[model samples]
Target: MDLPQLGTNLLNRVPPRLLSAAERYLKSVPLLRNRLEKETDSMLAGLEGDLKPYRGQLPTFATLPTQGLSHEQVLGEMSQMKEKEEHRWKDGLVSGAVYHGDSEHIDFLNRVYALNSQSNPLHADLWPSATKFEAEVVAMTAHMLGATEANAGRPPEQHICGALSSGGTESIMLAMKTYRDWARETKGITRPEMVAPSTAHTAFDKAAHYFGIKMVRVPVGPDYRADVKATRKALNRNTIVIIGSAPSFPHGTIDPIEELSELARKRRIGFHTDACLGGFVLPWARKLGYPVPEFDFRLPGVTSMSADTHKFGYAAKGTSVVLYRGTALRSHQYFTATEWPGGIYFSPTFSGSRPGALIAAAWASLVSTGEEGYLDATRRILETADAIKRGIRAIPGLHVLGEPLFVIAFGSDIVDIYKVMERMSARGWSLNGLHKPAAVHICVTQRHTQPGVAERFLEDLRAAVEHVRANPGEKGTMAPVYGMAGTVPFRGILSDLLKKYMDLLYKV
Candidate 1:
């Protein structure tokens, strides 16, 4: 009998509980554990060269040197590494990593960072400038995402309020933490849960794991957006919040936020729109006449949002904004201990001492790149994305996954899509490989907006398709890895592999 038939037969012979316990026992067995570790080691060994290219060539400082290295020597080594790495993203050969790589913009942000290097928001009295910059950054981001409309008749307390977090993950985790605390304190709910579409960013899962909140992931619709009905059904008395992404990370399709948030509103539960990817682009896109939906504070049901200033906002990498409908809700995100003998202590977000230079850089990026700058950048990015999407669809076996603005995901019906992705990588293109439905995505940025970059991408992509189609039997580096990751039925094995891979990163 086939493996599937044998599994079915075994399942029929044994109760699910017993089968699960037996599987756990088998996984825990010394021999099985050793085999799993061997498999994980093999996979990671293949990735080690790429992950640790400078391991032997450069200094591996597991501990600091007794004497400080000269600034010139340290900078020389750093410059060499930067020179090696910058070409790919600098020339638009990659995706998403370096959003705005223009020399002038980078230099300007660097100068801003240098000027504010010593400043820390934790010492507000010492560095009042950091406080002003953070407040203005939040206000500007909130206004851009419909705070003006949402707070037209409301007081300062009722107006949209937020804190600057380290990045999208921090922003999202902060919001989830806020909801957990709010629900526990107000609703007296001990077992809190959050409902979100499966397509939502994995940060929500991280938050769920970290904060002891149960995450109920509803499946996306046929179009790959969040399924409103399924999400509504996932909610219960213990549900503290519902999350929807404005252009989710995988497929770049915006969820039906209006409907999902409305459900949360009627229930008096929190609704968080994760706009980390789309927050900076969508508002400008809407102004330029894209079919942008209402996913921000303009919607009465949206109680909170998380937007990354680093990505499309064209700032230094560390800043993100997490906004709440009102100060009352945001207060739950704060950490305070007035009774501490050290002193009265309080922090707005997770971090106590933050890189205020990055906050200053975020401020500079926003102020310098005003509405006109963002509008122009958004226009170029969207145009490039449209061309790329059309090009992918034009390929014989490939199809673009959903309606997307800047991030375009495409899959194949007749080709080994991962092999195609591997071919693209061979041709100097770095793309995101997605599972669930085997696909690859390229997030369009200003780098791709440069002259000939989009054309080169499309041409290389077409050539990659043809290459994969011609070389059907040829094994490729990442293709087998992606194939195994996608098709493996034992998810625990994959999780263990990932954990081991993370362990590899810490090795000197």
Candidate 2:
């Protein structure tokens, strides 16, 4: 075996703590550190062209102009960039990024954004309209996700309450931080931990890292759902909350939230349902007769949830709702200072000042789309997803990962799926590449419901698979990177690579 592979095998056998220590020690060696830096620099250099295509073609500004450019000049430059970049997503070749690309909807949201551009939710007195929009957006999302049923017999204090967030990540982090504070103040648990399935969003891990909570990830079952028994075994006295996804990001399979949340409730702990992806779609999917499990406030054990108005809700980007079962729990998510030199201050979410325009757009989306519009959109998306799923299954080597509704993940037994993804990318398809099982997925949106998109996707996918099968010896740029990311045992190396990539993104 090669030396690098042999070293990786040895590193894989080491315990996690020891492996981490080894990673530190190895990085301390100048030769190894230099080698890693060189390799990463070489790898990223090849990607700089694709990442910064506007360089040399457009003005590169490292320093601001002494005087601002004219409005017409600025708009002209932006229009050029927009025209160049909008086609892939506008043509229904991209995934998840653009949920509603209709011209009329875009124009309507743009108008709403322009009208509320100066408003800020932080100054509620000055922008009561922003407050109204934020509150109503949260309420509309809550009601859509069974808040009315959940609050039927409860008092106002115990009714579903929430705050508007920047996006799914912020919403999830707010909920996790709330749980940590609630557990500390109420249950005296300082060293807090959370139990979640492996497939739960990584935002939970980000929360754990930020809030100093211990995240205990349990395994999933053969059907790609959370293993309730394993979750039960992972819990301890320090576990303040348990997490389940309405439908996870990678496999798109809903966890057993019914069982998992009940376990949390029986322990008198918190349960958070991450419905960021499925929250806006599954409600309508259930109404349309899809076999969606109980995963929201309708269940008695669910203490919190996050729903992105930006995703399937067809709202503009940068808006989401985070809901809690009671005002008492949500109070922990709030921040207040009484003795500050400036004055007494408070904020509901993570930010001190948030974009009221996004809130207004979210409110507008929820109100304008209404239930009927969401139902129609969900129907079209699910139908398109079903057709794509069938097409993937009909292909010889590929198999669908699970019974997914909108986000469909598929893998191949006879070929490298990453190569197929690269082929798809070459054909203007922007797909999500998943590791652990080495698969690729397309998050079906309103764009994919456009005429002929589904057929084109299937035809391209078949040809991509055939090409990969015929040319097994061919190497592609991204396939090896993905293959190494999925197979390499040294996670620290991959983490370093990602950090470098993030640094590359900031280069002007």
Candidate 3:
């Protein structure tokens, strides 16, 4: 076949309906499979250089080196990478990566981490401090999210309890798995389903796929909040849980957890509130008189919630807390295999071994940054966010989505937002690009709280918008990606590209 005809033939064979059959038929042909694999390997070869940037400059060890590298060499390389990555976040030129960038606070957390580096919670007998620190971290996070108010006169078992997970995704996945098990055991639900806002984190969908649960994603209303009626309609028999976010990742709009959780309560199903991005900041912002919604255990029907200590909580990057209304609900998340040759192999989370240093850093951060500290930090962050929101709103042709507090998403109808995003990225601002409705978001953090950071952001954003307006046909890297996805008829190509991207990420 000619090149054009061959391309058309391959494209025509890749339809969604024909995908499974194509895969089967193609796999049955060894030559076709070999050709495809070879092409993929060659394409991926071009990406391996970018993936392993430290190839010759530093030693790359997939396994333990026979001779340990000097500690100085390891620290030197880490310092070099930190220096390269820190300028944007440290100088307040980026979004959401480094929450609290004050050197003193980071040093303190690092000190705490160093103190507990050798401790492992899995070996509680050897390092009781790890368990104690983790327990306290959970307690502190729980109380911050309204556990104390919810369990004022309740029994110890009824009080809020939780486990510290690796990050927000783990916390959310653990909660979903818990609900799945709870529904199966208690309500005789074999095929469980969860009702979640379309704006809910993708982690819920990940959990549903991994745990054999059906995820019914209900769309958000015009204001970007979850549609309560749609959520109610989505729930049916075998519904295990309903999920809402304090402030969703896409539009930064808080869902009406009070109403949604109440609906779940009426149905006697579990309700989970994902507050990973906002849990630590919203309480203080509300106390500071910012308009915040009720999205915690303080609500009568919210059975569980997940909050990241890494984001706004100012701890290290590996820790988040998942709280349940009671110990019974959390027990569903544990694993125990008493008959194993390993002799009672058990773990509270997915991983067998846990990082104790992260737990210690989390605990230390909580204690060091008390209510007073959080209140002050929230004041700075909210004030900065307010300035940013106002600045973005003032710019012509651009609009901020929802009445958000900290995390702000804005887009333009008159210009391509992805092109604008590409401009911001070129100017050394790493912001998040959102699709489905095609918007870009800048998640405000402590980095943006620095002097003139918000002003610089506004200035850069205005310039970016102007550039995109002038050059309407500017095709940048992600601009074409988002544009193609939005305007294309076939999503199978996007799926394949995403799979390839994932493979690239894990190539090394």
- Number of the top lDDT candidate: 2
Residue 383 local lDDT, model 2: 97
State every prediction's TM-score relative to the real structure: 0.96, 0.98, 0.90
Arranged by lDDT, best first = 2, 1, 3
Model 2 TM-score, 2 decimals: 0.98
Q: lDDT by residue for model 1 over 70-118, one digit each (tens)?
A: 9998999999899989999999998798899999999999999999999
Better structure of 2 and 3 per TM-score:
2
Across residues 399-507, which tens digit of lDDT does each residue of candidate 2 receive? 9997888989999889999999999999999999998788999999999999999999999999999999999998888898898897676689889999999999999
Candidates' lDDT values, in order? 0.92, 0.94, 0.89
Clashing pairs in 3: none
- Which of the predicted structures, 1 or 3, would earn the higher lDDT when compared with the native? 1
Give the C-alpha miss distance for residue 6 in model 2, angstroms: 8.7
lDDT tens digits by residue: candidate 3, 456-501: 9999999999999999876766677677666443455456666886
